[model samples]
Target chain A: MMKQSNLLAIVTCALGLAALSPSAMAEQLLEQQCASCHALQAEDYASSTVQERAERKAPPLYYAGNKFRPEWLVQWLQKPERIRPAGYFPAAHTVPGPDGDVVDSDSLPEHISLSAADAELASAALMKLTPYTDKLDAVDYEVGNISWRMGNLNFGKFNGCDACHRDAPDYGGLSGPELYSAWDRLQPKFIASFITDPVAWDPHTLMPANDLNQAAVQKLSDYLKVNGEDE
Target chain B: MRYALVTLAVSALTAVSAHSWAADAEAGKQLYQIYCTQCHGINGDGKGINIPDMSVLPRDHTDTSEMSARSDEELIKAIKHGGKAVNKSVLMPAWDKNLSDEQVDDLVAYLRHICCDK
Candidate 1:
């Protein structure tokens, strides 16, 4: 009975260690694989080569915990789609205006696939992200106000958003989805990235890059996203 | 006297053609409910259930000022070709494959009637 008890204790210890090893290994692999494109924490890439290229083709993953589902993240990394369709670098291959000056655009290198184990680790590590939720909540705007109505009109008219996207004016060009309620559909982070730098998030998109600064981008993203909370 | 009669006949034909051009808003309202209400909402308010899931928001047909700005041609292009053709979100799938050209025309007419009260 004493010998059997010792064997049981060893087996339990071994099982616990084995379970811990994969999670640890996953964290290490995530640090190796994704640290190049995503900032695991704000400081992880603060002075690294990736940080130097702050205007990367992809958004940082530091807020993944707040922004995404673990299952979605896992699936996304395994089979990365062109989420922006246009390409990660929002302004790649765009033509200059009548002024004859070329615009700046970001370029993304080819993506490499990760093994299933590596993907699991990366997802686990990425889920640790959380940022700016307080600020996001503080700045939330009303969607049904007159200002929002005006913004929607401005987007279609002054900005010529309808020139390419298929939003309002009853009829317009069909290059983009109608913006009648984009705010409710897209992830806030993704919207912010697109608003901040289209080319950085997508490399092959045909949408012309607007010269919107960060503040304006956030405002636009907020306007688009604040509508139809229940829907 | 014969020329006057011919002119009157042409005038009658023109009137008929004009009347035909006037779309049936009632029919459009029904069609919108059946086909477009999924994304565009029951009252063209753009609050449909799928609106949240879609990357692009459906247009609110009630906004006359915005609708007035777009030409009929532009609207037709979007419906026939997907959003990508116009540098927009690819989420708005092309209805050309599913809806006939006549149906698209009717939809446009319906949009004008609902949005512009035309």
Candidate 2:
């Protein structure tokens, strides 16, 4: 009976330690690396003005949990892309205000590279973030006659969207990636980030900085999100 | 009696023409909302989501100076063949395959209504 009791205690202790493992590793990564660029928790993130300012340069991690697909996040952290071809700032000299500013402050440190283990831990912790209540529904915009034809026309002539993106008619410019299927590929918030501030994704893009009023941004995002349906 | 009959006939023709034009205009509005609203915006203000990331800002459909410079044929060609046909960005795809000639006409009429205050 005593042996069995000891065995139960050992199993309880092992289980408890195992449960603590993820949090402990996540805590270390947050303190050692991620805290410099992101806010890991909701309470601290809400209270943190410094972190908010830092976020002006990089995407905020508080919502990372809700925003990213785990597989995609892991891949992206391994090799970051210039999602915004334009530099993160519309202008180099000005410190961007939060409303439409996409630029991160120059004072913030450059992106730090991570080891494989660190990347996995950071991604795991980051994916635990859920900052926003709303989630975008992925519906195929190309299915209906009105949306499909209209979306096609808008992609072609009325807007001149094909200029920088390669998939358009002449495939003339290289300023932006071929957006032939960006809608099916990218996350909604990531797309929203571009709408909010083109420079935030890329500070050096040749693309002009558009001043999109809020409502227009939402509509455009809605349209783009559905543009490249399943593929 | 003959004069009265002629007047009635002319009036009926005019009414029929007006009704047709109205139908075209209505169709145009629906088309505009479905496609043009994204970049040109609901009000044709040149503020769309992709607008910010573009190398050249979208044309403000409401700008009289810009619109006045463009002929209806030019607009049609631009819409059909894309901006590159006119030495502009190829970012605008050619909609020849997507919109029928009649639909294009309807869209043009809609553009006139929204941008020219007609």
Candidate 3:
């Protein structure tokens, strides 16, 4: 009877060990390194004031699990790259040239990279962050194959998005983040939410709320997907 | 002497109010650097960095012929209410919420001065 009791105690103790779980370990490491920059437990997507956001050392990754593809996240974690060329705010970053373009490209702090193993662990932990999962359940969308011609027409001629973004690296305008790789970079649901109501995510964002429905936002996402795949 | 002093004070008070009401192109230029240059370009030429990203181009402020045709009231309306108010693009966000009435007029003054050399 004592032997059986001892065995049961050992089993219970083993299960109680928090470090035994990969997720727990990931959480530990995230607290160690990433907590300084990323809002690890950020339920609030809108971080704070304009000055606070402008001086932010890094972008929030609270929705990384839903915002980015695992493959991209893992790769990106290993090899950090600058995504927002013009920083976060149009007010803070934009500087006029003698002509009709931005003369001054604001300096952005480099993203601290992680080792392959650390990246894997961090990616796994980040993947578990699904703050929008419940909200996304209500946002039903059907991603279609948007044609390039039609997509270009809609983006450039109709919606006028091409004014701030481009379909290709060398083609589009500056100011907003580049869009050619948006489909791959951003999660489908995030793209939909942002386009549907920009103020919902970032109130200070220069992007005007166009009042697009779910369908229109999906179509735009689809167009980005098509364009993103080409080059 | 007291009459002269009163006259001077009245004139000085009127001047101060008039100065406050008059648009400050310098202040407008600073605001433009912070807000408008991202989409409207530095020189008001409508060819800002996000030009390719936009479906419709921003109005070129350097286009004297085109801008000259527009009255100060029309420009002020567009600045305060956004392009959609003037049946233009929706991309231009309403500055009514962001800028003060005086600031909007200053921007109008700046635009007028820059585009038309008025």
Which candidate gets the maximum TM-score versus the true structure? 3
- What TM-score does each of the candidates earn? 0.36, 0.38, 0.69
Q: Put the candidates in DockQ order, highest first.
A: 3, 2, 1
Residues A1-231, candidate 2: write the lDDT tens digits: 579989999999998877877768787777787776554544443353222331344445676765566766666667665443323322221232332223244532446667677778888887666555343333222222225556555544545545445343234233344454455445666565554554333232233334445554555556565555523
Superposition error at A92 for model 3 (Å): 5.1
Q: Quote the positional error of residue A214 for candidate 1 in Å.
A: 16
The lDDT for every candidate, in the order shown, is: 0.55, 0.56, 0.72
**TM-score winner between candidates 1 and 3:** 3
* Fraction of real interface contacts that model 1 preserves: 0.00
Per-candidate interface DockQ score? 0.01, 0.05, 0.31
Model 1 stretches with alpha carbons more than 4 Å out = A1-23, A43-57, A69-71, A84-108, A113-121, A141-154, A158-231, B1-118
The stretch of ten residues in a row with the least summed lDDT in candidate 3 chain B is: B90-99
Best by DockQ: 3
Task: Put down candidate 1 lDDT per residue, A125-193, tens digits, no spaces.
Answer: 766655645443543333332256665555554454554443432444332444543543445665666
Q: Candidate 3, residues B13-118: lDDT per residue as tens digits?
A: 9998767645487667766765687777766788776764465778999899999999998888887777778889866756664566887777887887789775
lDDT winner among the candidates?
3
